[model samples]
Target: MVAVFSEDHVSLRASMKGLFAQHSSESEVRRLMATDEGYDPVLWRQLAAGQELQGLVVPEEFGGSGYTWVELGVVLEEMGRALFCGPYFSTVVLAATCLVESADESAQKEYLPRVASGEAIGSVAFVEASGRWDEAGVTMEAKKVAAGYELTGQKFYVLDGHVADFFVVAARTSGEISLFIVDRESAGVSAHLEETLDQTRKLATVTFHDAPARLLGAENSGWSILGRVLKLAGIALAAEQVGGAQASLDMAVDYAKTRIQFGQPIGAFQAIKHMLADVMLEVESARSAMQVGLAAASGHEGLDLDEISPLVQAYCSDVFELASHQNIQVHGGMGFTWEMAPHLYFKRAKSMALFLGNSDSHREQVAKALGV
Candidate 1:
């Protein structure tokens, strides 16, 4: 049996890495970046065909191995490092987490197994025009109709909205927030892809014009569910950011050791040494924070991360930001060019750091958690 750690993961990661490395050639990365869909279908099928990533978070009963979140983190880090262009994050982590956060047994039974089997794609449609990730930011209203509920409002910056078959939308009903499941093909539902700086990850403007929606939980009890969802998403995103940061750090280290300047490898120079050491520190620190966050989310019991969650996220974001710029700095002019993949990783880092919450926002949360 294939393991999920060091050797097994590395071996599995190698194959996927080769696939991405082949496609990340200057021309291919640039072309895919410019395209509206932002990913190649052949590569997508390859991910599904191997099911190389199927067992991480999914429970065994749902046709998955029920492995630890850290295993998923390993895959995420490698994928982010390669600037792997795909829906794995938005669909698997973001949407799948939302499904697990839902307390409704009927909903989970109806959806998660399909996700585990790779038969359905879902997205967390929570953010609005304000880009707020909380209940107060949800202004979309759901009114009860004989058919179910009529949803009327908009969700902006929804990740993978253009392709998600089902959307876990946040809406207000009778002065409270709730999770609603809406079919993308249903009448009154529409979405258009949004232009984003990181083309590998797609964003979309979603509109719900009297769209009929099914409630996933108690009516008007959305805030409680969303709070839990946010915590889970925070942990997942923190993991992804950790993954992205590790990539930059690795690239910087390898480049520093090989690139020659002043008749010697730059790795011998004090300045380059300092930068690589700093990158190492950031990667290790971020990894520790992410591990703790994931452990807490994995139900270690009585571990209150209300305060710790944002700190890890903010810390990892800082790590990504610093490591990204440094990756470019270390490469000098070559890094600035589109032909090198350094800029691609840097671009992706910048975009993901801002999502969920930026370093600044997480700092604010850290303070809030302290009751200051």
Candidate 2:
């Protein structure tokens, strides 16, 4: 079941919608995507200082507003709706959440304040060449050194890695999985941008050759910590997917209503009507799943996040892809052109489905959780 929204939630949504409409329009998105940074630094600072969105979930003592996951979900949904090209997911959802979920309060205190104030950008590096999101995929070695620890391995498809100030990396120590915090400027560390299907969100191949690192949480407990973080990430991503799906549906419907064929609007046709109706149904269903997932993440009673997170991820992934594809179909030839917006959403949908584990993998998780 979807959670009911309060008046504050409504106000927040409206404020975010207005902000994105002005700052993250299609032209601005195109401009930012083509840049080396893939986002606007000025706007990022505004999000932190003016809106305090970067610290939405960070606690009060950490220079944050101490907001809950539900509030962050609201911001992410608006970002997805606008196709805002930024490191928000990498920083807030991945890196910040990793710090918050870790057992090390020192790490949180050291990092969360910078993250909240937007003084630094952070990302998580876990997946290797195998592109696996599970603990078994973490093959990077972290060896104890006189100074601290040294990490030696490569992490592929790290979000915003090229520009991240720091990273929360997963590595193996004495054959046990562990997490580490590695500075971007650490000796023997390098990040190379990789060509991706979605240029709006950048990915990089990060190499660590005996790079200095700080241990996060307890040894051999990285998987458990990461499990909790990934569940929240899945829920957050599902909310974003729901927003994107709704935007795609809206675009398709608008195009169908205006484009003329046979002396009538294309939307008047039975086939088009049915197609849009189906898209609407899928989008709404995805939204409901996302809301339920968010509720589960918020510790709502009787909601098991282990089951709901994967379910929401799988369902939202499929829905967003379908909606984006149908949007292109609705636009006909114009959608195929670079000047149009449908292709961008389509690419984002496809790329996001693969991130943090694809729909098929999530489905398997759901099956395992349900024992079905």
Candidate 3:
């Protein structure tokens, strides 16, 4: 087989960006944001055929592109820059990761191939009504039945929940967390797709009443897998933030260079220069943090990597949020308008940070991991 990355990754990133620029325009974005689907299937298919996004993590033996988290990070960063809305995160980062972490080889064989080929869109249904992100937040129960495990209760804030072909649900079974894969249109499974604050991303509330679900791994051993999924999701989210942060910075720089004040370009003003300088610092520092965290995640499996995960998540969230806010301020009142896409990215930054655990949550995790 060919090497995973050499010039390939760079070419992949560039091609994906070219695709984004080709397909993503402000009007298309506004139309996309207003839809309940929250994504464009045509665009998604284009991505799968063009860049092979859905196969980033799936093994080559299973019909995947077989790239590491770093390559995944590169493509995702470009997507973020374009504010591309789709199931890439829901299926690849969340659901695919959940399945990959499962101990069930049969399940992987059945699901990972579909996910890799973009034949199935899988999503994680872990959060509840109150929208808690912790594993302990799961109150849904599962019971073993002759047919299959029966599930009861609901999941809220499911990213891409309404449209996913299948779902990886976290449920309490025998008083312990377990993973289950349920077809979305299966009996007794219902989802209320709702309008969300971030139009670029979709959310839903899924209710289950004796829904038939196939087991993912060893029952009662799910929290461990969920924990690993969260760590990797954090890295993916950080890479996403790096894209948003740098994009925001670029937008601000371009505006500063062209937007004129009384006599000259507003960028010549001390205030704007300092603001740009500060943004540069935040972006670079966050980039470093993300790199370190990515290293920690993909490093030697048994190596004692310590608190790198939470640190990266916390720093990345803050830096992206900062960059988004500054980008708006730099653009003046025009930035606040819907005609401008600043708010799209800014909203995305906020949602991504909060979804896979946030700055504060990751910090607390870091403390717990540190035993402080």
Candidate 4:
């Protein structure tokens, strides 16, 4: 039975590999990044309708596939390998997970189906100019109004915010942090795209000028939900970083084997071989850490994610950033050139290391978990 399950896992990964190879080629990724929207809408629809990828983690009753975190990890790793540029992470991993974990059934019923169907692009706005990801980081205020609520403040580092149809915003209400849902096209809401270091991903600054919003969960109780959201997002991103590390290692090894230097293949040299070996070790080790963290987050009995999640985030970010740097070293000058793909992965590694929270912050979480 274990063998059978392993086979199933392999099959799922194969399917993802094929899907990305056909639709998310390197050229296609480059082309999509240059566009105004920074993603292929047709291919996005194909992924949603044909592959049913958008609803992979949503519960079956809520119009999703009812898949587990393990499956989402698989898809995320493949997406990272191909550098699939889209709103999948913001929509599924962040916003959808928040709704599923929140205590608001009405909000779940209203938004889950649209997100499952890929009819709406959703993002979570939590970061401010300070760029912190914890509950105390939120400074935006949601004021009580006759219409319902009014939000006034600005949020930066909103993933895919310029294109998201709606946002799950973290705001302060009566000295307590809360969550609210606001439409992107509302009268006083404005989303401006930011120029990010990684062109493959998008970020925005969203300003709420008395923008009308609806409370999501019980007022002053959204911090716990946001906590879960951050944990899940970290797990998902760790999986992606593992995949990216593998890709960088593969790129370095492949180039070393083919690129002749000093009248022989550079891979034959001891330095190149050692560098590749170290990167391979980092990639495999990080993959194991990510898999263990994914399992813990997926509700493995007797395992506590509070202990594993931060470790996974910190370690994976470090290894991926290091692997990307080593890949550039292996490629030499060509790695730094814009035309080469190593630069893209390098920037992605650096950017993702800081996403949601930086490695140092997560390391602090680990320290707190250990009571050190």
Best by lDDT: 2
Q: Is candidate 1 or 2 superior in lDDT?
A: 2
Q: For model 4, which pairs clash?
A: none
Return the top candidate by TM-score: 2
Clash total of candidate 3: 0
Question: Candidate 1, which segments miss by more than 4 Å at Cα?
Answer: 1-31, 52-55
Task: For candidate 3, give the lDDT of residue 322.
Answer: 88
Where does candidate 4 stray beyond 4 Å?
1-5
Put down candidate 2 lDDT per residue, 61-173, tens digits, no spaces. Answer: 88989888899889999999999899999999999999988958999999999999999899999999888998888888888999989998899999999999999999887
Candidate 4 Cα lDDT to native: 0.89
Higher TM-score: candidate 2 or 4?
2
TM-score, ranked from best to worst: 2, 4, 3, 1
Give stretches of model 3 more than 4 Å off. Answer: 1-8, 300-306
As for candidate 2, its clashing pairs are: none
lDDT, candidate 1, equals 0.77
| Cα lDDT computed for each candidate against the true fold | 0.77, 0.92, 0.83, 0.89
Worst 10 residues of 4 by lDDT: 1-10
